[model samples]
Each structure stands twice: as C-alpha cells, then as structure tokens.
Target chain A: MSTLRTEEMTLNMGPQHPSTHGVLRFIVRADGEVMREAIPDVGYLHRSIEKIAEKVGYHGFMPYTDRVDYVCAMFTNQGWGMASEKLANIQVPKRGEYCRAIATEFNRLASHLLSVGTMGMDIGAMTPFTHAIREREMINDLIEELCGARLTFNYMRIGGVAWDLPPGWREKALAYLDHFEPILDEYNALISYNKIYIERLANVGIISADEAVNYNLVGPNLRGSGIKWDIRKDLPYSVYSEFDFDVPVGKGEWGKLGDAMDRYMVRIRELKESVKILRQALKQIPAGPVLAKVPRNFKPPAGECQIRVESARGDMGWYAVSDGTGYPWRVHVRTGSFAAMGIIQKLSQGLMIADLVTLIASLDVIAPEIDR
Target chain B: MEAARIYQRIKDRFGEHVLEISDHQPDPFIVIDPASIEEVGSFMRSDPELALDCLSNESGVDYKDRIEVVYHLFSYSKRHGAVLKVKLPRENPTVATLENIWKSANWMEREIFDLLGVIFEGHSDLRRILMPEDWPGFPLRKDFVEPTEYHGISTVRESPIIRLDPKKK
Candidate 1:
C-alpha cells in the first residue's frame, strides 16, 4: 500500500542551444522547476589562443585577440595592444590616443547593445532584440569601414591605431549618435520598464557587494551589485580620464537595482554614456599622424607587465611576459566574462527553469571569453 | 598609499620569506618562497591597511628551471593593488592553495594545474579545465611536445591534402 514518487529530473540545457549562447552546456538537477545544481561545462570553443600567441610575433598575435571576445573586438584589440605598449614602453601620439578612445567606446556600445538586446530576447521580448541589432548594424558598418572586417577588427597596432579616421567619418558617427539615443529611450520604455521583464529580472539573481568583490567581478556585473569600480575611470588607461562620461551603478531603483534589472539598467545607462563620449571624441579629434615612430619589427625588452582594461563585460587583463623577442614568452588574458560566469552556479541555484535564461542573460556571459 | 609603505608592511610581517620587493614600471610586485605563499596571502588579505580582499587574477608561469604562481590582489576600499609571486622548483612545483582566502582562486588554481602541471596542495577539485581529461602533457610548459595525432585523428598542425581532379591537374 505504497504510493510511487518521482525523483528529481536531470536536464541538459545545451552544447549548441540558442539560450546557452555559444557552445556552452549546463547540467542541471532539478526538483520540479527549481534548480538544485547547475554545473557549467566549457571548452567546446577552445582555440588555444595562448599557445598560438607564443608562436606568432607580437604584431601577428593581434588577430587572435579579435577571435577571443568576438562581440567586443575593440576591447580585445586594446587589451593586447596596451599590454605590448606597457612591455615595450612605447608612447602613443595624441591623435592616436583620441582614435583609440573613440574606437574602444564604440566597441563598448556595440557589446552592451548585444548584451541588452540578447538578454531581452532571452527573457521573451523579440522586438527589442531586433531593434538592438538594427542599431548594432550601424556599428558593424563603421567597424568594417575602418578595419576591413566586421567582427574581428584588428584595428589597433601596438604604437597606435591601424589607420586614420576616414573622411566624413566624424559626421557619420555624430549622426548615428543622434539617431541611436532615441532608440535607447524606446528600449527603456519597451524592455526595462515592462512589467513582465521587471518581474522576471528584479531580485532574481542577487549578489551582494561583498560577494561581488570577493569574486573579482568586473564591468556591468560588478557595477550591477552596487560597487563603483571601473578600470577605465580608476586606472584611466589611454585618454579615458580626459573625456567626461558617467559610470552608472545599479541603484536598485527599478526592481532591486542589484539584480538582473540593475545589470540591464547599467548597460542601458552606459550605452548613453558611450554615445556622449563618442560625440565629444568626434568633435575634438585633431589632425595628426596616428602611428608613432617605432621600429618596423618591434620587440619589447625582457620583462613582465600587466595591463588591465575595462571591457564591455568586466576587467579584461593581459599579462605579457616578454623575453626581448618578437614573440611573447607568455601572454595571459584575464577576461571579465570568465570571472562573471563563476557567479552563475551560485545564482542559478534554487531558481526556476524559466528564471535560468533570465539569470544567464542578465550576467551576459559570452562563451568564447569563458572558454578562451 | 605609496607602494613602498605597503611593501614595507609585508616585509615587516613576513621577514626573509619576502624574497624581493620592487616597484617595477607597471606596478609594485613581490616575489616570495612557494612554501610561504598561503600564510603571506592570508595576512595581505586580512590586514586592515592592505585589505587586498579581491583576488583579481591568479596564474602560473613556467620558466626554464622553475614554475611561478602569480596572484594579483586588489583592495576596492583603498583603490590599491599588489602582485604576489611564488617561485617553486620545476622538479616538484606544488604550492599551498589560497582557496581558503578567496573563493575565486578555485578555478584559477585548476587552470594552472591543467596548463603548467603545478599542483595546488589542497585544491578540492584539481583537474583538467581547458584540455581534455585524458590529454597527455601540460600544454603551456616549455617542455610540452604537441602530438601529431590523437586516436587516429589528425591534430591541428597536420595539413589536409586537397585532391584535385585529373582535368584540373
């Protein structure tokens, strides 16, 4: 006279599913809809970029950085370039610095756009996602026009930018900015304040300031948890400090600011700030040589130097250990998304199946950054 | 908040175990004995003045004669940072784990184990992260030799032969 009962079911999210982003698999043990344990399985997209870097010369390795964080290509470009500059002790020209700032800020906007748009799609709003990519198309066009590639724009050279700003580029960029800000307002009205979106995101994935700092979370994920830390502002590599912009933090004003909502809000706010910075950069850019005077084949003196830059996701660090050779002895990338992904296991625990998509999307965990 | 004062405090506490402290061009970094890493790391994180609560990056380097474990620690409150290095002989490069101090060290230690073949003495799950579980050698080490084939499949280094049609040829 015993009744039969079902044990907890095991579910596999993806090694190729759309919601999992790129080649990421999660094994979840759940009782009903509530997740018991979510174990992330990576390495599906491992390219051995570090090993490849050891084989190529310093300049030749720039393209590999492009493949690592495919979404935020400029950040990767800057990370690798800045690391080489630090190790080589090369000085960039003023015009080169201005262009770097403009390109990096544009990349940040594009990355944040994808994150916000994809997160919206993950949470069941398709229209906002479409609108986001429509804006991102303009960014891709600009990047392609500048670097001859859309996604992997290896436009940053060690001494400076690969090329000068094209004619009428400033006017085109300013016009895009004018058009883009209104779309952001529409995005906020459509997704950020939507009752359904807020309900799914608010207080869903909560990481306190203590835990955030302890885990070394960077970018918007760290800002979302109410910590005011941005390498661009704090370290001020390049001319980021010269320009006036805001580092938006998650105040939990809309739907527990430190949760998924805060993460979304921070990106939206940053999009506006990036626009502001781009406008300033376009207006003030001077006409001069973009490339600094360096040897045709450059080699840094034997030493190790670490360069940390704020990527769209978090603090992207490149530690270059040189041996006075064209190739680096060792180059390690401390990606922001890799650090943010650690919190996923903790955040996803005890949340429902539907909430998992929202949580992962909220963190904006890019897979190549995790696997690389 | 000068870098020297922070190095001085660490030197005062650790004594001769602090091998070398210098303010290099990029930042202030210290090299210490591999055996003393855990104790020194705990002190640096807990000290109110240093308060380097955040473990920014933890990585391993494979020099010719020895292996080095580098930890980048930062203090959010103080807006200061320091690099802690522990060098161990190549023959037996095992260092005490810092997972007790900062939880973020968990995966980073595993990665070092996978790449450089350096073992963290007390890591809960020290296994291959980037490479396959059954993969032979530590990929990042200088001594590593890439295999031409694994289980009959050609490796990435092998060039595929393109068969041209007789007419085209």
Candidate 2:
C-alpha cells in the first residue's frame, strides 16, 4: 500500500475580499493554518494612468490623480499640482499654499484613521473600528462640503484650491478636531493595550532599519523600523516646514520591538501632529488671492522633472516629462502603497495564515494606489 | 548636503562617465554611460558622503535615437536627492540591474522593461509587468508601430491607396 502525499492547498484570498480592500488578490499556498507562500496578484484596477496622462492636458490631469489614492486624495492632488507648478515655473500664492496645507493634513488624518481603525478590526477587535470610522465620517462630511463628492474629491487645482473655505468652515473643522481627540484616547486604551492585539503585532513583522532602507520603504513603515525619515521634515515642498510638529519616529515608543505594533503607534502619533499642523495653519492663514494668476491654456517648456511630497502613506512622487505642449509626454506616480507591497512579500514568508490579514492591514496597502 | 555640492562630487568621482550635471529648477541630475551604471550606482549608494540609501524611482524614457533609463536616488540620512540617467541604443537597449542593491528596484525595473523594452542584464524575473504577456511592441517607444493586422483583423490604414477599376475613367 502507498500513501499519497498532497501538496499545500492553494487558496485565493481576494479580488473582492473585504479585508483585502480595493480589488487585490492573494494566491496563498497553505499547509493547514500556516501560509507557505503568498503571491500578490495586482492589476485588477489598472486604469493605464501613465498612458492616460499622455492624452490629458496639464490641468485636466488633476482630477485623475484624486482617484489614484482615494484615501489620501488631497496629497495626490498636491503632488500632481506641485509637479505641474515646477514644470511651468509658476508660483503658488500664499493663500493657496495655506489652504493646500490644511486640506492635505486633513486628508492625512482621515487616511490614518482608516488605517489604524481597520487594523484593529482585522486583529479581532470590533468596537474600536466602529468608533474610529464614526469620527472619519465627520471629516468626510467636511470634505464633501468643500468639494461636491465625499470620496475622490478633485478639489485641488493646479495653482491653488478649487475654492476657498466656505462660511463657518474653520469653526466646523475645529469642532471636529476637538471631538476627535478623546476618541483617539479611547482607541489607544481599547486596542493598543489589548494583550491579544499586542501579541499578534509586537514582533511579528519586524523589519530592521537596514532592511527597510534596502527595500526603499517609506512613511510609517520606514519610521516604524526605527528610521528617522519623514519627507515632510526632510524635504518640505509646501508650507510644511513652517509649521511646528513632530516627525514621530518609532524606535523606543512601544517596548523595544520595532514591528507592526510600532508602525501602528507611529500613525497615532502622526495624527496628533497633523492636528497640530491644522491648528497652526488655521490661525496664521492670511486672507488674500486664493488662486494664482495662470494662463488659461498653460504649457510648460520641454523638459523633464520629478517632485516628491510626503503623503499620508509615504513619499508620493510625480515624474513628468514635457514636450512643449499642453499634455505631458510621460507621467509616473511612485506611490507609497506600491512600495510597501514589496516588503509584504518578504515579511509574510514565515507567518501563519491567520496573521496574514493583520499584516496586510498594518501595511495599509490601498489597491488602487498599487494597481494605478 | 546641498544640490551643488553633490553635483560637484559626482563630477569629480566619475570624470568622463558623467555626461552632464545640471542644477535645474526642481532637482539636480547626473547623466552617465549605460555601461558603468552599476559601478556609479554602487558608489552613490555606499559612499559615506553621498549616502543615497534609498532608490526612490527607476523609469525609462524612449527618445527617437536611443532609450534613456533614469534612476532617482534619495538619501534620507543626509536629506539630499540626485537623478542618474543612462542612455542606450534603441536597437538593443540593455543596462545592468540594480536589484542586488535595492530590492524595490525589482518592480520599477520590470515596469521600465514592460514599457520601453529595455533589457536588464541580471534581472531575476524580467517580464512584462503592466502589459499583457503576448502583447506586441513596447507602446512607449517612439518607433513602436501599432499592429495593422492581428488575428485576421485588419485595421484600416489612413494612407491613400491607388485603385485599378475594370472601366477606366
């Protein structure tokens, strides 16, 4: 008699799994509860964005950027606008810079809220996720009032914002900030201290500073591994340097483990710093022309340039090569999510199958950002 | 370190391999030869003064005569950036891979390969990333000709064609 040996069972985790978020699929070869190999299959949400940029004019391409990283739409808008401004040699007005700073910081808060909150849900803690998203909805309401849409708001224009702050916008935003702090405290108390959550994330995905640098990881992922690098502080493009805020590095924050838990804590600290930036921006903003005086049909000279901005995810870069025309010859978005996904392939190699979702959530891999 | 200082160091280090160093409005770029890319790249990454630890981006631009491969490297420790360019002949465009230095270069090189058809000499899995497996010529190249006939479907050509009729006018 001969016994048949079976290979590891292959399972598909999603092109539509709720935890996988945004059209992402994982081909997992597992033995019982242990994952042997996890192959990430992308391109489901591919919009051929680079090719599309070749067709659209400079300013017309702004709207498409909002869809690239929907969670942090303002950063996407700011990155594209900054690249265009650099190419055209146009200066943004003081008022426009202040407004862009505020909008981008607000979007940062929203992106981190979803990242940390959904992270809790993935780790089997349900209440914190509900509480965190409830706060995010309030911010979404403000974004909707600013732009017509709740999500994918094409609000940032090339030279400035689409429009100035509406009536009572600052007061309402301040009220939301005041309301959000206590809830964040509650989240820290609820999930950050939970033993089960701590065990799963404490040292699970520990990427050292050397490995993080080698992989070119950015944002909280890099910081979490004890690298004191934040694009906002290191290479400030807009009015970020003028503001007073801490670039939270996660070396000794939570135990000695620079792992997934450290990344989660760094995000929480960044949220507080973002709030501080918003407060200073709201106080010192001078009233003047919100839009810069740019030509109706703007055309930059034939040249190639690259601009990098610190988004909520990480270093969001836009490389535009112009051909002395209204449209760009080529545009490439170096998205942070796409960079972070590279690390996951290495980190998930030895982990259990159950821990995979938690690891994915911790990385905050937005699929459109990856697919685009 | 400032952009000017880095430009000077790059010029001093790789004398002739450095094609042109310019302090443009946005950033500074050093254009170099495609053959010595790996040596120059290793120096940029490991040199204590120019610690470009992070490979920010890798992309390809297709000019009419040649294909240009661009590498954007940023040093977080020193808070400086430099763009490195390498040009290759369009006929058989090839460059050494930097995957051994920075792991993230893996995907970006694949992207360049898929779009511009530039072959990386030592890439582990050099395949089309964004495009389909059995796709035609690279779409981003200037000389890329769209298929006029594929799978028995003939696309209508815009050029005028001479006709011979049974009854001449």
Model 1, span B1-169: residue lDDT tens: 6677888898999899999997776666889888888899899889999999999998888889889998988898998888889988898789999988997888788888988999899988788877888889899999999898878877865457877898984
TM-score of 1: 0.96
Q: What is the DockQ of each candidate?
A: 0.69, 0.43
lDDT of 2 by residue, B1-169 (tens): 8777887887798898888887666666778888888998889899999999989988888878878888899887787788888989999999999998888898888878888899999999788766666779887776677677766778556768777897997
Question: Over 4 Å off in model 2, which ranges?
Answer: A1-6, A252-256, B142-169
**Number of the top lDDT candidate:** 1
Mind giving the per-residue lDDT tens digits that candidate 2 earns over A1-372?
Answer: 368776788899998988987888888988888888787777788776777788788888989998899999999999899898899888898888999998888889899999999998887788888888988888889888877777888888888888998889999988888888887888888888888888778776778888888887889988888888887887777888889888887774445546888888899999999999999998889899878887869899888889988899998888999888888888889898888877777887878888889788878889999878
lDDT scores for all predictions? Answer: 0.87, 0.85
Query: Which docking class does model 2 fall in?
Result: acceptable
The best candidate by TM-score is 1
Q: Tell me how far the alpha carbon of residue A29 in candidate 2 is from the true structure, in angstroms, after superposition.
A: 3.1
* Model 1 DockQ vs. reference: 0.69
lDDT tens digits, residues A178-276, model 1? Answer: 999898898889878888888878888888888888877888999999988888888888888878888899998765657989988989999998998
**Chain B alone, TM-score of each model?**
0.91, 0.83
